[model samples]
Target: AATEAALKDVGPIDLLVNNAACTKLQPFLEVTADQFDLLFNVNVKAVLHVSQMVAGGMKTRGSGGSIVNVSSQASQRALRDHTVYCSTKGALDMLTKVMALELGPHQIRVNSVNPTVVMTKMGRLGWSDPEKAQTMKSRIPLGRFAEEEDVVNSILFLLSEKSSMINGVALPVDGGHLAC
Candidate 1:
């Protein structure tokens, strides 16, 4: 309800961006159910709740709108330490497709942007140590991490009319990391 109320000030929402995330890296045996629920609630449930709120207006308008969810390469490419994170994003990726199909008739487009190792502030914290950074860098086929601009361009494309017919898809902003 708070999420919806916050959007009330924005009036009608033409674009909805679901970009929340949480991660806990631990050995399979070390993970607690509580940790799992925390990530799921923040990463998944919150997205649905917000999307539904804005989507109603989009549907009623009967013209069109766009929903862009930020998923991750982890959704498809498994990292050794990312068990719960991968599962949560995988669910997000699936939700994008399901929502796309269900909302297509309303001209409400639903899609996802899946990035690999982006060098966002939070992302860099995970490998602030030079040795860890190098190790992480080696895994990216592009030989470098993703810049914010790289992701912004993809997102702008997806949000713009250029991607009018694109839906139910997970477009990779990964610089071909999955290919490597």
Candidate 2:
């Protein structure tokens, strides 16, 4: 409702960034139905809902737009204890591709950014253990986890005219983590 009201007040939207997500870190065998539901609801369903709403307006306006889904490296790589989170992100990546294919005619481009551990508040706390941090960083050729700026820059590129030709791509901002 808030999003609908905002659209009414602000008029047609040219860009939609689906960045909402949730996670529950537990062994795959230990994950419960409720936990999986919660993660999927926030990480996948919310993006689908919001994008449908925004894309409708963009379509009607015929002005085309960009949709950037903030995914994670987990979408492309398996990680222990992140089964639910990883699954949701993988779903999101596929959704991005389908949306791109379906909406391309209307000039809507959809893409996702898959970043490794970013040093945000949550990221810092999650990987604060020196041993774990080092282990993760060693995997990245750049020898460091992503900074918020790195992800932001990639998003800006995808949303800007600079990336007009780019669509349905799960671009990694992981400092070469995916390369390895």
Candidate 3:
């Protein structure tokens, strides 16, 4: 209902960013049924729901739009204590591909930005332990994690006409972590 109300007021939406995400750091064996459901509900289901709603509008408008789902590097590689979170993102990446394939006829491009751990205040606080931070950073060729701007800039590029031909790509904003 809230989504419908927002769409009604926004007119035709030419851009949609399904940045839905939720995570609880737990080992795979310890992740409870309730936790898995919560993560999937927020991370995967919400994206599907929103994309369907927005794509319907784009198709109706007869003008192609772009959708950028904010995925994570964890989607491409397994990370410790992120079993369920990684699963959610992996599903999101595949969802982006299928959405692109189906929506291409309408010129609606769908892509994702898979960012490394971004250094927001929460990120910094969470990774404040030097030993843990270094362990993660050492894996990246750039020897660092991404800044918030790094991830934001990638999203902007994908959404802009500059990347008009790019679709169904899971562009990594990780500092070469995945490359390594």
Candidate 4:
């Protein structure tokens, strides 16, 4: 329980960021049980583990804090071959809401930041093909995929006091991709 130990060592954690994820881009039939478990273990279970560990401290300390999970637009929009990935992120989105509801009384805010295609290493592999990239961009109202800065801004906002009153929300920083 490294997560719990870390919380105990720190005495009280003011923030938690559940950013782990795994994806196997294959057709539904090709996804094995092991692949499915791997995705859920990292994307869903890890979030629960870390949040539960830190949230208790924030509650007992009586000082409010923020918990931001990095979800994906796949939670709302389907991709061609991301069945397991999408499901795990969707689960994280729901968990953020439930955690927020449970922890609100203790002044622990739980929320999520969802981003569409970004220009990271992973995004390059997923969108480097010009035709595919264009098709993907077409679905976004902003007419472009997200940049790293776009996702960072969303996370920073959730962490800052500026979002103090905002809780249990899933903010999509997807360049309007979900709007389509």
How do the residues 1-180 of candidate 4 rate in per-residue lDDT, one tens digit apiece? Answer: 766666666766798788777677888889889999999999999999888878877877889799999999899888888989999999999999999999988888899999998788878887789999999888888898888888888898998889999999999988777876
Residue 124 accuracy (lDDT) in model 1: 78
Ten contiguous residues with the weakest lDDT in model 1: 120-129
- Which pairs clash inside model 1? none
Off by over 4 Å in 1: none
lDDT agreement with native, every candidate: 0.86, 0.92, 0.91, 0.88
TM-score-sorted candidate list, best first = 2, 3, 1, 4
Better of 1 and 2 by TM-score: 2
Candidate closest to the true structure, highest lDDT: 2
Q: How displaced is residue 54 in candidate 1, in Å?
A: 0.9
Expressed as tens digits, the lDDT of each residue in 1-180 for candidate 1 is: 778678889888889889888787777778889999998999889988999988888988886899999898889988776788889899999999999999999999999999877788768776577887777678777778788788778888888899999998899888677877
Between prediction 3 and prediction 4, the one with superior TM-score is: 3
Task: Give the TM-score comparing model 2 with the true structure, all chains together.
Answer: 0.96
Q: What does candidate 2's lDDT look like per residue over 1-180, in tens digits?
A: 876666677767898788887777899899999999999999998899889988998898899999999999999999888999999999999999999999999999999999999988878877888998899899999999999999999999999999999999999999999999
Candidate 1: lDDT of 166? 97
Q: State the displacement of the C-alpha of residue 16, model 4, in Å, after optimal TM-score superposition.
A: 1.6
Clashing pairs in 3: none
State the lDDT at 116 in candidate 1.
77
The pairs that clash in candidate 4 are none
For each candidate, what TM-score against the reference?
0.94, 0.96, 0.95, 0.93
